[model samples]
Target: MTGGVVFDPLLPWPLIATLGLVALIGVTLALWRGLSGWALRALAAIALLGALAGPVYRVEDRKPLSDIVVMVEDASASQNLSDRPAQMQAAAEALAAEIEARPHTELRRVTVPDGAGDEGTRLLETLAEALAEEPQGRIAGIIALSDGRVHDIDRAPPLPAPLHLLLTGRESDWDRRLIVTNAPAFAIIGEPVILTLRVEDSGAVPQTANIAPLEISVDGGAAQRFEIPTGRDIDLPLTLPHGGRNVIQFTVPEAEGEITARNNTALVQINGVRDRLRVLLVSGEPHAGGRIWRNLLKSDSSVDLVHFTILRPPDKQDGVPVDELSLIAFPTRELFLEKIDDFDLIIFDRYKRRGILPASYLENVANYVRQGGAVLVAAGPDFASADSIWRSPLGAILPAEPSARVIEQPYHPALTDLGQRHPVTADLQGEENWGSWLRQIEIETTSGDVLMQGVEDRPLLILDRVEQGRVALLASDQAWLWNRGFEGGGPQLDLLRRLAHWMMKEPELEEETLWAEATGQRMRIVRRSLGDEVGAVTVTRPDGKTLDLALEQVAPGRFEALYDGPEIGLYRLQEGDQKTVIGLGPAAPREFEQTIATGEVMEPLIAPTRGGILRLEEGLPRLREVRAGRPAAGRGWIGLTPRDAYETRDVRQTPLLPAWAMLLLAAGLITGGWLREGRR
Candidate 1:
């Protein structure tokens, strides 16, 4: 209970002050006139004025409240390294016991986990939330048990008391981390791309650990090793082997005394893109469908087209002289023999062998396909004649042979069972609404998968692999009829584009592929194949643990399975002969980016609160009580300010003097003054 005297005015303060001034003036006048009862009159005026100014005594019933101490436990991934988890656990238990032992204090324990995805440790954010939920006046102090590798330090809340950090890791702990400071999202294939990276050593790094061995692997291929010095940025010049996502893994062997090898490796994914696609379009004769190939290739700004038409063959004996004719001679030697490899894809549109390209030039074309080149053949009715290019040496690389037959009936082109699953024709839109083709060349598929069929279910499209290259055969040259919207136009553009890209070895268009994509820690493993079913994929985690995941057929030839990776790092996936590597989160998660524990990040927030950082290596500091403005940490102890907070249960007020008592006293003083004056 507490008591204090307070004023409860009977009238307005200004009115009371005016009346008291008037009474004081009357008393002073009486005294100036030498009145015998001047002292008695003054006494009477004082009694009346005191009665008018109401004074009361107040008493409050008070209850003491317990002070709250917020303790944030950093259970993030970084705190799990080495013996930090044990250290943190021990400190937390000790702190909890201390709070319970205190006379009037409570503990608010908050456990901070790893942030979703690569957001890292959100210790400060968690602390802020805890502080917001608790009453500020009752909070005594804030404490965090962590490695101090918090990622969200900028979100520190306004501290109501001293904030202390009990650092979790040992002083001798060390780590080696790979940092990719500069990696482009997209890089031109075959052109050297400069990637900036640095290998860093933190904590108590050894003197002999100045140089580290760095191994680099692209697309999960064999790694190339190099000796690189630490503590400096190295510019790595790399050319991607193929287009699409190129997963390049850079690893530094874990040093002898390093805390973990997780940070020693980093994965950088760069999409490889071609500078430009060079296409050689060879037209045997000027036909209606010849412009279709030209238009399709010309539509894409990335394709560089070189078109040559045999307008007037050497056998055409028109009376026009060579000088008078506007025809430019086809550079057979430059295109087929000398610079064939310069083109990424070569298209033969209705091309039939005239005396134009000799057997030697055709043989060189076949060799070009064998030496990692791409060839696409669009056959016309002439392909069934004796003049067909199938009679040439290039037929060896072609997937189909001409059957000396032509189908003239109009028929809608349809995807075969394999084509429905093949990337080139898989799920192509508006297949049922496709227009009809008036003509198709009959052919027997000698090799490769038949992707499409024409009249009487003859092979319309065939794709094959030749040694290190690729070849595609489209039996009909009348696909331009779809372009003209006969009945209803089909996905001609999409089909041709996919077919061309597939032959050019685009990774997305491959018939057999294995890859994984990640959103946060969850991954979608995809398997694309031409076969009826694929075997289960074996997933190898960064820790070398392996698990076989069976996939469900989502599409005809596409199988997929969802996996939630336990941690962030490079994951290797393999199904049969197809193998791929993907990084789930960041190559080096934020937790492992700085495995060595330090108090530098929390120092700024701690200083203003007069709090100290105590390393667990020095042992857990004893908890003590200190005043709010004083330093809250000493050599072997940390302090929490005791907030003398209380709750008021009840309050009572009593008048110091009653109105009747004040009136009686005033009347007595006045009578005494009158009697004295009468005697005088």
Candidate 2:
């Protein structure tokens, strides 16, 4: 208990002098001619009047409330990196015990959890929330246990009392991290994209330069290795061969003298799509489906399709002389050989040999297929006739030999056994509204995989893999019936798109390939195949653990499974013999950039408040009592400021001596004074 006397009214000297002025005025009026007796009487009256002014002093008993001590602990990802986690745990326990030992003091522990998706740790935010619940006067001091890498520094609350930092890591603790300085979200297919990356050494760097070899793999294949300089940034140019999400994994062999290999590897998923796909469509004769193919391809803004229809062949000569003909000669050699590489895809729609293109020109077309080029043949009834282009030099590369037979029968275009598994024609189960093709061409294909079949099990569509390229054959050439909705056709656009993408080496179309997609914290593992069943899928996350999962078929040929990652990081997947890597989080975090313990981050707050910072390793400082609004710690030492908060469980009030009592006392004194004066 404590008690003190305080004045109710303490007037300054100026107010006292003003009262004397009024007395002097009264005396001068009473004795205008040099009055000594009146002046003396006036001074005595002034003294008596000053004593009558009400001034009171009272003492109150008070009991101080318990002080509040805040303890902030960092529980972020970086805190769990090395021995820092154990160190922090130990320090937190010690600080809590010490704060609890203080008399009449309560401890408020604030836990800082890891930020979501590379946002880093928010230490200041936790402290501010803890402070809002307690009274400012009851707060004694604040203690923080962290790596000093807080992302929410701007949210630090105004210090109600002294703030202290008890840092968590040792001085010799070091780290090495991979930094992707530059990466693009989209890159042109088959074009090289330049990426800027670096390997940085923090804290205590290794003495030896130990330049490690950097290996890069696209969609998880054999990695190409290159020597990279250590402790500095380097530029790497990478080319993507196919379209869609191209997963590129960059890794450097773990150096002999490095801290952790976590930062030695990085994964980037960039969308690889063609800037423009140039296609040459040669149509021997105009048909309904021919216009459909042209229209569908032309609608896409990314496709550049050049359509050419032959009105007449060069060998055709009527009764009129060659001079009478106004047609210009077709540039066969220029298109097939001279500028062949410029076009990405070439389509021969019902094209027949007419002496317009020599056998050597056809041989050049076949050679183009052997050198990583794509070609497609759309055959009609003429493909089985004597004028078939297959009889030319291109026969060696043709997957099917046309039997001289024309089956003029209506049948629904059907998918073969393998077609149901192929990505292009798979899952096009048009059983609900099966469409019909009016015409069917009889063709005998022994070597190629039949994808679509028509009338009497005749091969309608055959797909073949040639030397370093892909070729597709459509036997009937009556696909235009689907475009015209001959028998309630389904989505014709979908079929054509899948076929084109499949021929372009889309990763999703591979018979045995591993791929992963992230959907807001969960990753979906997908494996596509042409076979009836796929082997088990294996997954390797950023944490370096492999998990083999049995795939469940969701569609006709697609298998998928969901894997929930514990945290945001890179993940790798492997199914059968294929592998892929992808990043599920942002590049880096602000706190992970610096794992060392330092008060530098909070130095500005500490210096202004006259608060001292003491490390846990240096031992906790003794609690001290200091004046309010004064420095809690003086000169090179640290201390806590105590606030004297009194609790009033019950207060008593008493108003003594009424106005009538004062009036009665004044009347008696006046009467006595008058009697005394008369007696004198």
Candidate 3:
């Protein structure tokens, strides 16, 4: 119990001061006049004033509260590398033991884990959260055990006492980090795009004059090695071979005495976009559905369509001026023979051979197909005639031959079993209730996989690969009915777009392909195939370990597998002839961005509190108590302030003396003074 004397004034402070002042002035005047009883008068005045100023002795039953000393532990991913984890654990245990042994100190251990996404070690955030639960007055000190490479130092809370850092990692450690300073998100296909990168050496960098050899690979192809100077940016020129996403990986081989090689490699995903798609739309006869093909190609901003249409049949042309006839002025030789290979897709919409494109020009178009080009034939009534384009030199590459018979009945289009597996028609079950087509040219399948079928399950659409190129034959001209939204229409736009992309050899629209996408540590593996069943996929991790995972069929021709990734790096997947490489998370993780830990980031925060930054390499320091604002750290010891905080459980108060006793005492003193003056 503790007690102290406190004043409880009977009157207001101002009134008490007035009465005291008047009594004092009277006493001083009597003393100046040499009165004999001035001393007794002064003593009486003092007694009266003391009675007016009420005084009480207060006693408090106190309980001492422990001062809280926060011990922040860094268990982030970076700490897991090398021997930092061991060092941190050792320091934590020693500090916890010492704090618990202290007289009135509590240890609060807060473990900081890895941050979300790219946010690195968040030690200050974790420290502040732990402190929010404790009383600030009792937070005597904050001690953190980390590599000191904190990413959120600005969030350091207001420290009432000293904050000491027990840094982990050794001074001789070193690391090499790869920095992708600049990379383009989109690049034109077949064009060289520049990527700027740098290689940095940190912490006790090796004394070497040799240049660093860097290896670069595009789309998981063979890596090309180049020697580059260390600690400087280098511009790399790369060309994308395909028109789709391209994963480029840059790596530097490990050397001796490095902390880790995790940061020595980096990944950059660049999308390969074609400059412009040149499409040639040739019409043998203009009809109601001719505008449908034109509108589809014209709507896309990327497509450059060159349309040449014969407005009227040559045999039925009325007497119009030769110059007025658009067909008379058409340039057919220049398109078919001169720049036939320049076009990515050549669409023959309802075109019949009527001496427009000569036999030699038709042969050139067939040669274009064999030399890695695309052709799409949209057949109509003219396909059944003797002048059919299929009967020309192009018939060598056509997938279907006209049977000279056309089904004129209305029938809904259907996907064949192989069509359901093909990427172009997969997931089209939602559009099964499509509007009927009034006409479909009967054809005999020669070579190719039939996708769409018309009346009696006859071939409506046939896709085939010739040599190094691809071709698509649509045996009907009634697809435009769906574009008019007849009977709630169908996926006309989707089907046409996929069909065009498939003919253009878009990577994502390939029928037989393997790909994977990663989020955090989980991977979603997908395989698209036209076969009945796909074989198991073999996945190669970043560490070169291989695992074969059986894929489950989620939908027709769609196979998937989910694998929990173990590390952050490039993953290679292969199924049949399909092979793809994808990077999970960052190629160089944020944890190892600065593996060689130092207290540079944290020194400023601790210096303001007179705390010291000590390395745990020399072992955990001896904990001691010290006064606030004093130097709390030395060569071998760290100090924590004792808050000496206490809680008052119960309090009692008693007057120094009773009011009646004070009054009686004052009367006796006054009477004595009166008697002495009377004697005088």
How much lDDT does each candidate structure score? 0.90, 0.74, 0.88
lDDT of 2 by residue, 576-617 (tens): 677776667643445556666678888787777767666655
> For residues 498-579, could you state the per-residue lDDT of candidate 1 as single tens digits?
8899888899988889988888789999999988989999999988999999999999999999999988888999999999
RMSD of each: 2.9, 4.8, 3.6
Could you give candidate 3's per-residue lDDT for residues 1-680 as a string of tens digits? 99999988899989999999999999999789877787888888888888888889999999999999999899888898788888888788888898999888888889998887768899999988887898888989999898888999889887778999998999899888889999999999988999999989989987892468899998788999999988888898889889878999999999788889889899999889999999999886778788888899999999999997877655665788777654555687789888888899999999998876789999999899999999999999889999899889999999989989988988889888888888998767565678878999999999999988989999999999999999999999988898998776788888888898899999988988888887788889999888778899999998899999999999888999999887778899998889999988888878888888888889999999989899999977888889988999999899988998999999999999678888888787778777887888
TM-score of each: 0.92, 0.84, 0.88
Give candidate 3's whole-model lDDT: 0.88
Q: Model 2 Cα RMSD, Å?
A: 4.8
Clashing pairs in 1: none
Q: Which candidate comes out best when scored by TM-score?
A: 1
Stretch of 10 with least lDDT, candidate 1:
584-593
Number of backbone collisions per candidate:
0, 1, 0
